[model samples]
Target: MSIVDRALNVKEQFLQELKELPYDTHSIKLFKDKYLGRKGLIADLFSSLKDETPQNRPNSGKVLNELRQFATREFEAKTVYIDNQNSKKNIGDHSLPEDPYLIGGIHPLTHTLNEINFIFTKLGFSTVYGPEVDTDFFNFEALNIPKHHPARDMQDTFYVKNGIVLRTHTSNTQIHTMLKNKPPIKIIAPGRVFRNEDISVRSYCLFHQVEGLYVDNNVSFSDLKGVLNYFAREMFGQSVKTRFRPSFFPFTEPSAEMDVSCIFCNQKGCNICKYEGWLEILGCGMVDPEVYKSVEYDYDKWSGYAFGMGIERIAMLKYGVKDIRLFYEGDVRFLGQFI
Candidate 1:
């Protein structure tokens, strides 16, 4: 065959061999050495060109190089395609299914918070948020829990300056909401709160809370019970029961602690509920008249209720987590369980 025809024939044969290659690495390496390697067809062409006339030698060499370049690219692409095909086949049904046990899920706290927000949103409450680092005015005085109040000391707040503090509760956002918006206001503020407490199974320096507020003319105690009852049923189960125990707080005059029947033992009593057959889930009450006055709302013309709950506490009870510290420690083993 003429030199160009011979080179073209070799390239076509090389590509044909590539198409039939076994989808394996060893077979691929053998093909690579036989055609594209240094001692292969293109290398022999260099030696053969010396025998041609000077003019033909250059053309012959050009065609031979072109053939080698095309073949090299084609073979490289084929190698990748074959490797991928083999990889998929090896990972196919003949292979064992991966253990579903190895997979994980969303963090318990995140799951609980999402459920809480979902319920509130369905009830027409808008979600609002504010800064974690706040001034004493918004965190305390604005909420009617001013300096020197026993309630201020109850939170064990982390101070940043003389009066600046890491927010002790999501309640700080309530003041901002009131100041910026007029009544007919309904909002849920969910966020991280900080304290100065010693870390332990039950308490931590930081946690999360979701505080809710609803204000309008004619809001009353019955409205608070109705909303919380709906929340308990939706969060725990349709049959879950809730009760309001009279409580005291600086910001809410008719403050009460909300409790749901112990879900762990289904109100049969459990250690998680301190064996009392009840789990205190949140705090709720009517907003104090002083809180309204701070925002210049006419308390005599409007009345409302506010509620607050710790996210970590809800997460712990839902998942049976014994230690609050487990939620804060950045342990991969602990996190992977949720991921």
Candidate 2:
């Protein structure tokens, strides 16, 4: 049919539907949405105006406008009628107690991620993100983890079809960042990473991480220590003592794991600290020369450090949450306490 004929049909159908609409909210909403919503029949009629010939465009537009105005008035009148009908009916007990948990608070993991990002952003690191599902090249090969390297074993990854895998760490963001921007680069990649590990109280197949990177001339292990020490104090408490023990990672040379004294036992042993007086918090080291080679940067001219920490671990420590599973479980009672 022509635009005018279609508009006339729609107008008649709308009037018939509006008059037949029962005195109820549900029917009224359906009538309104069918004719008056953005993608409704009336709107579709308006959109079809471009197909009308130039000579007929003005007349077709006027007809559509009149139809819309009439439909809108009818819809509003029906809505008011339904509202009046609903108001006249009895609503249930007004004196009943309000729901105890009416409002929701931020998830502890999210709060912890924000806290880590805020601390580093204040320290001159801009927050950056990369894909959770990435190729082995960016996820591994670009960070200097070649295919036969034992570092591939460090993170049991979930491989998708055709050699793509869920990223093992947001450290993948480092490769993405350095490729896009030149140095004096400072960024923190806060995102989710996945592993092929078995689920347990302490371990899950998936978790969140904040991977930090800094690159420039003369950046050093000393600079890494100073920034991390300040972060440790800020995140845990002003009195928390931090120490670094030599460790290894494929992407960083001279790597170490950082630990803070157990706050719960007051420097005494506890299960949360694995009966040790210290709790390992994060891993860090000077960026490996191989990493610079992967990104085509001159290792001698540039120096930097990379660090990563799990969001769940930090939330567990900060909130005394023993099970890492609690963060993932949809337990509002457990989550509600954070408020």
Candidate 3:
């Protein structure tokens, strides 16, 4: 008989057998083994295609493929029918309640970022984001961080080719926002930053940051201090005390680091605070005229303030998490505690 005729005969036989087949697990499994197993009839037919005449092989192959597809479709439908029948027969406890699936929660870092965003949003600052993979100008030059600047040493940036890099800080966004928009801008940048640093309890190679910027006709140091004071109070507690000590940053001429009295030690000093009564939370300063010059903003026409905090550090302090590495590791037990 021709291959097509043989295929038709096989399909007919399968249809007859399917009509008489018992709808049970054992019968359906045997049916699958006979027709669709690795060494079953369909495989044997495909293997035989190589022996057919070259000119005729295509048509024979088409018949065999159709037979296989038809058999597969019928087999799947039968299996599903049998399964449904079995399910109805096996209904032993319809009254029993289902075991509840566990619900997940916001990661501690995310929770802290949300809290920071909430506080800023309430203060008339809108959230903004920038690329993790960024250019040297936005990441360093535009922020007034030079190629050989000592501040570069602090970030330990991961360079990508000539002028590209994994952004070392969300401050990159400050430059981008300023360049794209006219002044009277207030924004908070929240995103991941990369650093080539040795991993330890207190530090990790990857972390998150929230950087803030405000530029307008008249902004000042006092305005910077007020915003930070409000942030510390809202994030920690209404009673938490903050301090700003003289510090230096490449992008800001008059820079200071903000610290909050250690909630863990209540200003008495502890290991978490490294025996200091304060925990450094963020860095802030008046926007340097040099930084404005890079973005073509008239330094004479505008003044602004910028501040940034490491989100991981904030989470560590707020949630009492010790190792920064724990935040990255997918440890359900550690994460579940936050929920």
Candidate 4:
């Protein structure tokens, strides 16, 4: 056959093979070698172009380029098809059920803290914060707990260098607030506090506290009761009942522990309430004169009420959580219950 006829025959065979090419690595390689490899049909046809008659050489070159282009397009298309098929195999069946994805949620203590802040803010108390590591003056002495006072022994303190300590309560923020501004101060401090204590179902060495302070002329224990009662109703439920038991604290002259009727027992007997039907929630009293003296505020001109509550304790009471330790443990099963 003439060179032109020979090239046309090879072109027809190449086009036929291209159409039948299989979707797989081995099939693609074989198809390429058969028609497009260095020594394959298309390359050999191009090599023969120089031997063709001058008039036919132009026609031969055009046909050879077309053949080359056709083979290249078919090779790329097959490679993409094969790659897609392999990827689908590696991914497995689409109908199969997927493994569960666990979503995270806020911790119970944090949720309680936010709720407490919201309640106090509604009562016109601005949120304030202070250092977790504070000096003895601010953490203790400035709050009227003296170095020689027996009340100092009440808090199992983690003392740091040079009379500084990890604050045992958020009340340290009270001193910081008072020193910075003059009264009509109404603020709530919320933050983590550290103590030296054994971890137990009831207590942890580290916990959260929220302390509220409101200073102005003529502030009284009745104002304290009114605010806390409103907080109890907002926090627990509209029907929650609250009372104050006489107590003592170095910073507050006439301290009292506030208690709410147990929601679990509805004021009836229950282990959560120790069968007393009441759960102590927090402590409150008028700010002590000594505290004002330490902060250099005139005790005669300014009086306020300060109250504090443990966030963990409040969370435990609200959620019926039996163990304080569970709050710290990173158990997904326990935490997932909150979500």
Candidate 5:
């Protein structure tokens, strides 16, 4: 065949190869390799320039350029059409529900924290914050746990350096708030707390705590009970019962452990509650006069209540999560359930 005819035949074969091809990166790459790459039909056509007459060379060159332009336009058009189709497929049935991956949710810990905040916020408590690295004065002394106090042993605190330590409780924020801000101060301090402890199913070195403070004139033990009762009901269920047992904390006078009815069996008891028919949910009490003295609040004029609960513990009970360590471990299997 003539050089022009041979080039035409190759062009026909190239077009045929591309006729049923999908317009995507892979297909475009193959088209370039088979028809436009170095040694491809178009390159062969240019190599034949020497075989043509000088008069016919210019016309032949122009025709070859036109054919190349046509092929390019065809490829570009198909690419645009394919892209539009992909976009349409992605936007399919907007009225329909989204796919599982798109319907992500908050982490269980986050959800529990939100619920706790919501419950307290409704009771006129504002959120408060303080540094995680706290001085011994605020984290310990201000909370009435002296350096020699046995209660400090219970905490297993991690000392950052001389007198400075990673706060063992969000209660440190309470002391900071009390010193900086005055009474009628209803605030909740929610954040992570650290300890020097071994990892286990029920315990971890790092955990979260939500510490609450309510101070004002005539804030009584009854008021403390009322607030905690409302919180227990709001969190566990309206039917859940709450009670207080005599306990001890350095920061509170007549401290008590707050217990909620076993939610799993509605107070009938279960493995979760250790068959006790009650679960100790938190520690709370009438604020100690010593705590007031540390903050320089007049004990006679101002009285209040303070409470603290472990976020991990609450979340575990609420969601039936068996392992406290799961909250710290970023296992996709555990987290995917919440998502």
Candidate 6:
């Protein structure tokens, strides 16, 4: 046959073989050798061009160049395909089992605060929030903790300039709420509070508190007891026992601390309860007349009750956590237990 015909046959055969090239390193190497190698079809086609007549040589050379270009393009594409497949194989098998992805959870203190909020909200108490930083008027004076009072010593406050302070308790929310809204106000303020204290298993420089306030005509200490009793049962368990012992706070007259029977010991002595079989959970009482007077409320006309509890303290007692520091430390092993 003519030189052009022979080159066309070789080109057609190479193109057909190229179409069947497998995407693998070994198969790609063999494909290169068959079509584009030194002794391959394109090289053999060029070798045959020298045997053609002068007039046939031009057409044969053009056909040979076309075949060379086509073979080169096909070989490069196949080489890239095979290289990518090998690279992916070297990287890893996507189908194999993978290490589990860790899931995140709420911090223990936040979790407890949410639970507290949920309980009180169910009891007709709306959730309220207030500023962390405040003046002595709101944080202390409004709550009947006057300047130079012994009660100020109890808080160990982190005071800022001009008598402003990082609020010692969420109870400041009570003053804010009363001033803005008339009586029949029921609110539970849950937020972070700061104090000047040494860090230890039982105490921290900063912690969370939930302050509850209920005001209206004839609001009584019995109402405070009933609400807190319900809270203790809801928070601890339906069977949890609670008691109120007379305590003192500048804001709440007839102030008392509410204690829950040690869950760890079922009211029997234990290290968790300091072997006393009782753990103080919160402090509460009727709003003192002075607190009402400071807020410009007629103490006789609008009586109320205010209660406050430490969120970290509640979390520790509920979870059997020994160290208060563990709540703040971002240790996965310790925090994961809550989840």
Error of 3 at 3 (Å): 66
Best by lDDT: 2
- Please list the C-alpha lDDT of all candidates, in the order they appear: 0.88, 0.90, 0.90, 0.90, 0.87, 0.87
Q: After superposing candidate 2 on the true structure, give the runs of residues whose Cα lies further than 4 Å from its correct spot.
A: 1-101
lDDT, candidate 6, 1-339, per-residue tens? 876677678777877777787776687778788778999877887888778888878877987898789779877876777788778878887897664447678888888888998999899999989999998899998888888988888869887898899998998888888889888899999999999999998899999999999989988888889999999999999989999999999888899999999999998898888899999999998889998887788887998898999998899888888899998789999988877
Q: Using Cα atoms with residue i matched to residue i, what is each candidate's TM-score against the true structure? A: 0.70, 0.71, 0.71, 0.73, 0.73, 0.73
Candidate 4 lowest-lDDT run of ten: 96-105
For model 3, which pairs clash?
Answer: none
Better of 1 and 5 by lDDT: 1
Clashes of each: 1, 0, 0, 0, 0, 0
lDDT of 1 by residue, 4-34 (tens): 8778778878878887888767888888888
TM-score of 4: 0.73
lDDT of 5 by residue, 15-99 (tens): 8876777756887788877767678778788888788999988888877787677777876777788788888887878788777
Show the lowest summed lDDT stretch of 10 residues, model 5: 1-10
Worst 10 residues of 3 by lDDT: 96-105
What TM-score does candidate 5 get on C-alpha atoms? 0.73
Better of 2 and 4 by lDDT: 2
Model 6 TM-score, all chains together: 0.73
lDDT of candidate 2 at residue 259, scale 0 to 100: 96
Q: Write the per-residue lDDT of candidate 4 for residues 282-303, one digit (tens) a residue.
A: 9999999999998888888999
Candidate 1 vs 3: which has more lDDT: 3
Regarding lDDT, does 4 or 6 come out ahead? 4
In candidate 5, clashing pairs total 0
In candidate 5, list every pair of residues with a backbone clash. Answer: none
Candidate 3 lDDT, 12-37, residue by residue in tens: 87888888889867887787887788
lDDT of 3 at 296: 91
